[model samples]
Target: MSRSIDYGNLMHRAMRGLIQEVLADVADNGLPGNHHFFITFDTTHEDARLADWLRDRYPREMTVVLQHWFDNLVVGDDGFGISLNFGDSPERLFIPYDSILTFVDPSVEFGLRFETQDQESEAEDAEASPPLRARRDEPETEAEADAAGDEDEAQDAEVVQLDKFRK
Candidate 1:
């Protein structure tokens, strides 16, 4: 199979731009009016994590919501960090740059899309970057635990709204 196209970099730039947009908003307007983000990514994708048990639980893909009551939001050349609320508790997370895959903020009807290789890749490793391109934690539920046990990493048990895409 041969085709003349740059779909690889195309998708990469698109995702990069998408992330830049969100970052731009945060940089310029400062997370306007309760407008936060929900990011999902793979834990073992190089720079993502969850609580020990949480990671041991949901090993595949994990998602976390960033809104009010979060703490220690640190953005770096690689990934980001924040403190989010989990099941009746609070947990701090450090998401790497290469782990993030999907980022969405339904409040303003905005979302960022990142293209991965397979079902395993898109398994929700949410964090951070590369040219060939890139980039979770927690299984607060059984599915999370099953996924976590599937991989060996520092995952967490953060909270994310998995029902936004449903109608």
Candidate 2:
């Protein structure tokens, strides 16, 4: 075995990149059809920013559905921002990608789970995107953001099983 290699970290980075690519595509064009995202993240993560009310509701982890109701979905180098409705009120959220735990596109049964520990402390690598900084004066309401797309036709997807990717 090559002691200098860190395949697990590389795999994690690659997986994150894939998610970013998908989100970037969605930003360009709205979710195609029948496709939506179920994203789970650490609600209490240092980089996560949510309305006080929402944070109080989900003190630890929370999953959000990116379907028909979200707006202002902006995918930045390090994180993403979106506006979700809370009892008819639109609340904005900013979540760093590092805080993400599970990302699933059920339409195709494609899912990825990331190991969350040490996520924030890890030094930035070439493969990772740069961090995003929020502008204090930016508008709260932005143009509606596009959703992730999915295919209407269902096809068998192969499952790749692996032990924990972290040592």
Candidate 3:
């Protein structure tokens, strides 16, 4: 058998498309009850441009929540832009699709992990390739899955910016 097809890459691209679709829908109709997103991306990716302060803080990777306090959320073909509050201050973040590492909607226990071309091609050995986790249809609680690790990590990457929206 020949390994001519790059199904893995195709799958990753399709998943990114799904993300764009979901965000586009949210942009158009608003998030339907209880549904939110936890998006983790590589900060150093060439296409990723974060606030200087944010870049300094999350030098490697960062996760953002799309629940309540984000504005001007625009999802485009190559990347996305959203305004979030940081330390009660508003900041805009632009992340390219290729920079994303993981996207999880703990509300529904749906998650997708990605392996970028740069990342996959960097390793000299195939064993070093990132494992692709199959999506589980089962719905679980945020406390159980904890996709982004702990509340501290979530707080560290506080892209939800709820303070400004809070009274």
Once superposed on the true structure, which residue ranges of model 3 sit more than 4 Å away at CA?
A: 1-3, 117-131, 137-167
Worst 10 residues of 1 by lDDT: 128-137
Best by lDDT: 3
| TM-score leader | 3
Clashing pairs in 3: none
Model 3 Cα displacement at 74 (Å)? Answer: 0.9
| Residue 157, candidate 1: alpha-carbon lDDT | 48
Expressed as tens digits, the lDDT of each residue in 1-167 for candidate 2 is 55687666677777778778898888789787988887889998899999988889999988888888988989998888989887899989998887887777767666676755354345254334223211122211113112222322124558876765656
Model 3, residue 139: C-alpha shift (Å) = 12
Please count the clashing residue pairs in each candidate, in the order shown.
Answer: 31, 1, 0
How close to the true structure is residue 167 of candidate 2, measured as C-alpha lDDT? 62
In order, the Cα lDDT scores of the candidates are: 0.63, 0.72, 0.79
- Model 1: residues with Cα > 4 Å off, grouped in runs: 1-7, 17-30, 119-167
Residue by residue across 17-83, what tens digits does model 3's lDDT show? 9889999999888899999888889999998989888999999999888888889989999989999
Question: Which is superior by lDDT, 1 or 3?
Answer: 3
Alpha carbon lDDT at 127, candidate 3 = 48
